[model samples]
Target chain A: DARVTQTPRHKVTEMGQEVTMRCQPILGHNTVFWYRQTMMQGLELLAYFRNRAPLDDSGMPKDRFSAEMPDATLATLKIQPSEPRDSAVYFCASGPDRGTSPLHFGNGTRLTVT
Target chain B: QQQVKQSPQSLIVQKGGISIINCAYENTAFDYFPWYQQFPGKGPALLIAIRPDVSEKKEGRFTISFNKSAKQFSLHIMDSQPGDSATYFCAASGWAGGTSYGKLTFGQGTILTVHP
Candidate 1:
């Protein structure tokens, strides 16, 4: 399965610490999406990129959270001064075309902020 | 207007029974609807999809019924088995130039349990 690979499947950090999650999207995939999953909110789209250009990130908290795709193959999400409420599983997904296309998602990185 | 609301946060069904999940969207511009299935400890996978051109689409025991006028869609799983138990999500996206594809949105999700 030419799946999207996410690094640091699990991360544990304390409040006020910086946490970064990385994803390697499938080859030739042009669209990438970042999602956050938790029991209370369910699966929510945090941000997304079309052809490595950020399209919408209004769902994400701009104060501390940031998402970037440095290149076609690598996308990163970072949180500065992480808070306990930020604990959740973050998933990375990629699509061949527009958001209407089927998105292939990664296993997700479970973050635990104490 | 970009929200997709799903009903019955949880559901339970007996073996061989049918499980139905419904979703409604306020964005009429959404032309594509897709259903995703997710198990514990895994990312959601695309289960089935439907386009606005058709009212009903069926593949095996899974079916999607779309109502363009009502702006609603539903997923029906027939002859359900225990393996079919999982969280189901309904999503919608616009493929036309009028509405940007970035409008893709997913429903809250429904947890379905099938007892054998």
Candidate 2:
């Protein structure tokens, strides 16, 4: 079965380090989304791309967080100078453009910043 | 601000019993609602969904009940099983006309534990 693949299931880095998470969306999917999950905030949408173009990144912190889709299958989220508060599970999901299509998510990349 | 709200952060039910989770949304523009089930260390998977046009939708033992006027929806699992223990999340998305269309707003998840 097709599934979204995420790399580095776990990551631990000291403060001020840069963390990068990558996702390989399902083949033929046009929409990709990046989300951060925390115990206090639940799941927050950081950004999303449609057709390899960013549709929204308003939820992302422009100063430190960046999301990009270099190609249809590759999507990445990077945090520079990561702080302890940046610790959370980052999930990447993809789906078709159809309004009702359900998002297929990757297992996630658990990041810990000390 | 949390646009979607889900209650019963955690629930416990005996096997063969019914498990219910409720969710409410403040945005009337939301036209599609879907529920997701997530197991430990796994991504949330789509369980079931309903639209404002339908009052209820069911697949096997899982059902989604939607109420447009009340701006609320619920998930009911009949004959809950031990394997059914997991986290359930309710999500809403706006229609085609709205800017947030296709961008799902997810509610805080509910962890369900079924005792066998």
Model 2 quality (TM-score): 0.97
Interface RMSD of 1: 2.4
DockQ of 1: 0.58
User: Taking the tens digit of each residue's C-alpha lDDT, what string does model 1 give over A10-75?
Assistant: 999999999999999999988889999998887888999988999889989999999999999999
True contacts kept of each: 0.53, 0.58
lDDT of 2 by residue, A1-114 (tens): 999999889999999999999999999999899988899998889999989889889999999999999999799999998999999999999998776888899999999999
Candidate 1 Cα misplacement greater than 4 A, ranges: B96-103
Task: State interface RMSD in Å for all models.
Answer: 2.4, 1.6
Candidate 1 A-chain TM? 0.97
The two-chain DockQ for each candidate, comma-separated, is 0.58, 0.68
| Best DockQ among the predictions, by candidate number | 2
- Tens-digit lDDT track for model 2 on B27-50? 877888999999989888999989
Candidate 1 per-residue lDDT, tens place, B23-95, comes to 9999877888999999988888999999999999999999999999999999999999999999999998886
> Candidate 1's C-alpha lDDT?
0.91
